[model samples]
Target: MNFDLNTEQKMLKDSARNFFSREADKEFIREMENDEKGYSQKMWKKMARLGWMGLLVPEKYNGEEMGFLDMTVLLEEMGYACLPGPFFSTAVLSVITLLESANEKQKKRLLPKIADGSQIITLGWIEESGTYSGKGISAKAELKDDNYIISGTKLFVPDANTADKIIVAARTDNSPEDPDEGISLFVVDLKGDLKGDLKGDTNNKSINIEALKTIRSDKLCEVTFKNTIVPKDNMLGEPGKGWETLNKVLLKAAVAKCAEMSGGAKRVLEMVVEYAKMRHQFGRPIGSFQAIQTGAAC
Candidate 1:
């Protein structure tokens, strides 16, 4: 195997590193965590202009169509910067799901907005079960005429408070023997049936988005939907096979996270090495000390 980044990929990595280092400093990251939306739309807009948001989408849909390896390069930078907000939810999870399962008509209707960063979408799969498997999915959905009424609680959802749309997993049919059966993916527009607006700031009447505080500070959310209606046209993939579809998406997600973690760990290692070599202790650089040298080596 070559085990090396191509020229374009290396350029992308350097560009991303420079951009994030300048724009995503510690102050920006801290400020974002407290922001109601968990990220700056202004920043997202800037990224859209840079075409980072559309790096993997098909060019026909206003995207670069670069593929996953390229997207992973960008994701590595994102994690290294500790960039906050719906980028992962909208760009990675939701977009990949759409590409994998959504029909042409649906992709045409949806991909452009995401590619241009005009819309933010998220996935809802985890529930009280707390597992990312079919056994964890207990949310229910019922097909009525041309629509589906979905009701369920999703826990540890990503950036739900700020998303314009949420792609949910619901149970269409119950089968004790087949836990994966009856699961379906539905796109729920947050603008639907809300008393005020989609922002949830106008004294939110029906929308339920709660932040789940954790040491990680990754803008984790819990979303509850009661009798929420979704159009049949919003279905992402075949009904009753959603668990299988989502499992695949989760695998992709895991790979993306690993890529990001690798990047972040690399940065941490660099910083530690620099500190060890620079910091002086007992009349010598800490890096010269056997203990510090051993720690850095390990």
Candidate 2:
């Protein structure tokens, strides 16, 4: 078997590389690190115009109807450029979850907005336990008359501060026999009366989001939900059986993240080789040294 990118994949990789090189240079990336939203709306719009936001969405939903491998090519380029934004959260994580679990009506209602870049969604999974297992999900979602009241906190949620909606994993039933059972996924509407710095006030008290400074300076937040109200129709997948869908989301996310890291590694290697060629020591370029060459070869 041959391991080669198809013609379309090659074109996608090249276009993404060029776009990042021209638009999201080192300086721009640094600026976004300090920005409140941690990304550029201008660049987001441009990517939307490029149909990147809809890469995995179905054509009927105004998407490109691309496959996972195609998405991997694009993500690799993004990682090489160290692109900072909600693209991973919105495009990959949320999109896959919706596709794998959402009902037809839910997809029709939300997928179009996501494809057009008008909507940004993130997953609210990791909690205080900081584990990615069923036991890690301690948040509770109680069903009301026509709504589900979600009360819990999510840690390390990417781009929650800027997302229009969040797919929250909550425990709808407490089954001591099996921790994974009775877990449900709810698409919580976060859009509300805008206050400041992307903060909004929902009907039942505003969802508190505190930005956490990470080593990569990526936009990660600790989101606190104090009686968040979600419509019953907003639930994704079958009730008490959301773990299967969430598991699929996590698997895809892992593969996408590996692709991103590969790109970053490639860029680092290039930078190191360039530096070795430029910096000379003992009247000879470092790259000319056998030791340097051997290390680079690996």
Candidate 3:
């Protein structure tokens, strides 16, 4: 495989870096952290206008149809800027899962909304078990009259409160013997619920969002789903295929998280290098000391 990025990819990376550096500055990120939604509508709009929201979507859906390699570059820049948003939850996780499992009409209906930044979506896959195993789905979806009623609690659902839509995983009809089998994906309109929850924030004035505390300020919230009803057409793909779809979404999210961590590491290195140049002791730059140099290398 060609390891080198082509001209177009390099340009994309450079452009994204510039955008993040300028728009997603420290003050901007700090403000987002305090905001209930933990993100800026202006920034989201800008990203949508720039097509960053559609990085993984198909061309027919107004997305660039770019591969994960390009997305990795963009996410790295976001990490470097300490951007606080649902980019990973909505764009990477939810969108990728839907694209992989949803039918044609589903794609046509949802993808464009996501692409235009009019809708923010997230996947509700984790349950009270507090596991990412993807096999322990206790949520049930009972079909009745062209609709399915979902019941269960999902813990640590990333950005659930701010999402316009939720792609949830529920058991349609499967036994305990079937690990990840018998689970299906469903899309639910959280427009009303999400709005009701965040009721008085600026811009998203009707939404109630709470950011859980963690080393990473971008924290996931614990979500409880009542007997939520979803349309039958919202079921993604065939029954018992949620595991496959979720696996794809998680892998992509993993790559995105790794990129973010790598960016943070690089930023640390840059800070160390700057300190080594300016920080001094005993009439000499600390960087000139052998032990300090060795420590930095290590």
Q: Top model by TM-score, which number?
A: 2
Q: Write the per-residue lDDT of candidate 1 for residues 1-298, one digit (tens) a residue.
A: 8879999899889998898898889999898777777788888998888788778789999998897998899899888888888888998999888888888887887788898998898999999989888888888888889777778899999988888888899888866578877898987787554433222222223348888887867778999988776667778788888888888899999999988888888789899999988888889888898887788788
- Candidate 1 backbone clash number: 0
lDDT tens digits by residue: candidate 2, 205-294? 547888999998898999999888777888999998888888989999999999999999999999999999999999999999999999
TM-score of each: 0.93, 0.95, 0.90
What C-alpha lDDT, on a 0 to 100 scale, does residue 235 get in candidate 2? 90
Candidate 1 TM-score over all chains jointly: 0.93
Clashing residue pairs in candidate 3 (N, C-alpha, C atoms within 3 angstroms): 197-207, 197-208, 198-206, 198-207, 198-208, 199-206, 199-207, 200-205
Error of 2 at 148 (Å): 0.6
Clashes of each: 0, 0, 8
Error of 3 at 126 (Å): 1.4
Error of 3 at 249 (Å): 1.8
User: Once model 3 is optimally superposed onto the true structure by TM-score, how far is the C-alpha of residue 51 displaced, in angstroms?
Assistant: 0.9
| Angstrom error at residue 99, model 1 | 0.8
lDDT per residue (tens digit) for residues 1-298 in model 3: 8888888788887888888888888888787777778888888998998888899999999888998888888888777776788888878997889889988888887888788998888888887777876566888889989777777767677887688777888888757565878888887776654342223112222223344676666658765556666668778899878888888878878888999878878878888988997998899899999887888888
- Return whichever of 1 and 3 wins on TM-score: 1
